[model samples]
Target: MEGYGPAEIEKLLPAFRAGEAGEAKPPTPEQDLLGGPATTPENYTLQLSQAQAASPVHQDATHAPPFLIMHGTGDTMVPETQSVALHSQLVHLGRQSTLILIEGFGHGFLNPGNVTELGPGVRLDNGRLEREPHTGFTAQQSPENPFELEGLAADHEMIKQFFNLHLG
Candidate 1:
């Protein structure tokens, strides 16, 4: 989804907070998918409001259902803190939430090739987020790594268990 960058964000925050339409401003930077300074299409405020309207995080999550949020520590596209904050909000509001932060895993870390490289990630099943400080095989292997296969199996089982506990 196309979005505002740091510059546009600075401009939009005031209007959004006041619940007003965005002011007319020329596009600032080259358009990029990573939310970098980009050429914003016409009607910037309209887009911003639309995005906020569609975003779950921006809306009222009071009646939200259970959530299984899995994020990679190495993900550059979106910081791990975003997921953490979401999980925190959900739990604070007496909602069911689970967060798993896989270490050394970048974007699309759930792929078979994306095995733990730095170490074991943390899990927040209870209230507190606990880090699992343990090293494992890296994910940068030419041939399909055995560690990847093993990791995939373990992850699959975890998903199954979560589903069974919640759905069954």
Candidate 2:
């Protein structure tokens, strides 16, 4: 539901419609949000700008909901710069917004649970991810490793608190 529109959605639709297996995973750049390596620089910029325009970045203070952006620092698929832009724009527009860049985390690492655990197939040799006992989520970091924000209980708590404060 988050970005990864059209092309990605098409891939998911058949799987849901048939209630069966879906297309195999595409390359990360194609499968992830804003991962468009559009054929050319002009094309990429145009597509990206168009997509960004459709996001909260285009919304003025009068036209957007409160934003709480949580992103991982080590995400290779979608970079945090996108969120940073949105948050910066929101703040500049005098809108209520928050951006939390979870260190030792990567793109779409947000998970809600009591503990954060590395999912299967996480390559330990990469040194990008480490498990957290307290939260059971991967929250550790190495100076040379990338980060991914696993959906962790602590993340969930933050989400809950945000909702309570905003929706209460």
Candidate 3:
């Protein structure tokens, strides 16, 4: 995660996760990949400024609506702790908010489960053709399956119930 740029990060995506590498590899400077070239104080300031500008300003908690926050524990782009921090802040301000953490998932949870073919063929968001991973189950190893869909579905349902209780 530390030694990844936008391009390198893109390659780790689902579409490229299984694709064969091309002959020509793009040149990525070591400094660019690591925390050397873009880790200047000015870069940090710019990032902070951008985040502040993009963040929503909180209103008075007394009039705010209930909130449901879902965070993926394996999210490398944005740490799951950020959601926890926000949830804690809302609770501290006497607002109704619930945060659900989905384990073993990265930023993309729209498609869940072990890697499998979609059908005859299909194209992914990143333009590579492939099937998404199966939802609610892990992959089998040594002719033995370790994935449990029922448990994952139950956890997903619990999150739904929590949202319904607070938001409905």
> Which candidate wins on lDDT?
2
Measured with C-alpha atoms, the lDDT of residue 148 in candidate 1 is 24
Clashes of 3: 2
lDDT of 2 at 106: 51
Candidate 2 structure quality by residue, lDDT tens digits, 70-127: 6565554456666666566766766666666656565334433334333544321122
Q: Score candidate 2 by TM-score against the native.
A: 0.50
* Each prediction's TM-score versus the true structure: 0.50, 0.50, 0.43
lDDT of 2 at 7: 19
Q: Write down the TM-score for model 3.
A: 0.43
| Candidate 2 ranges with C-alpha deviation above 4 Å | 1-49, 111-154
| Deviation (Å) of 63 in candidate 1 | 2.4
Q: Spell out the clash pairs found in candidate 1.
A: 29-38, 30-38
For model 3, the local distance difference test gives 0.40
Q: Which residue segments of model 3 deviate by more than 4 Å? A: 1-47, 56-62, 111-156, 166-168
Q: Give all candidates' CA lDDT scores.
A: 0.44, 0.45, 0.40
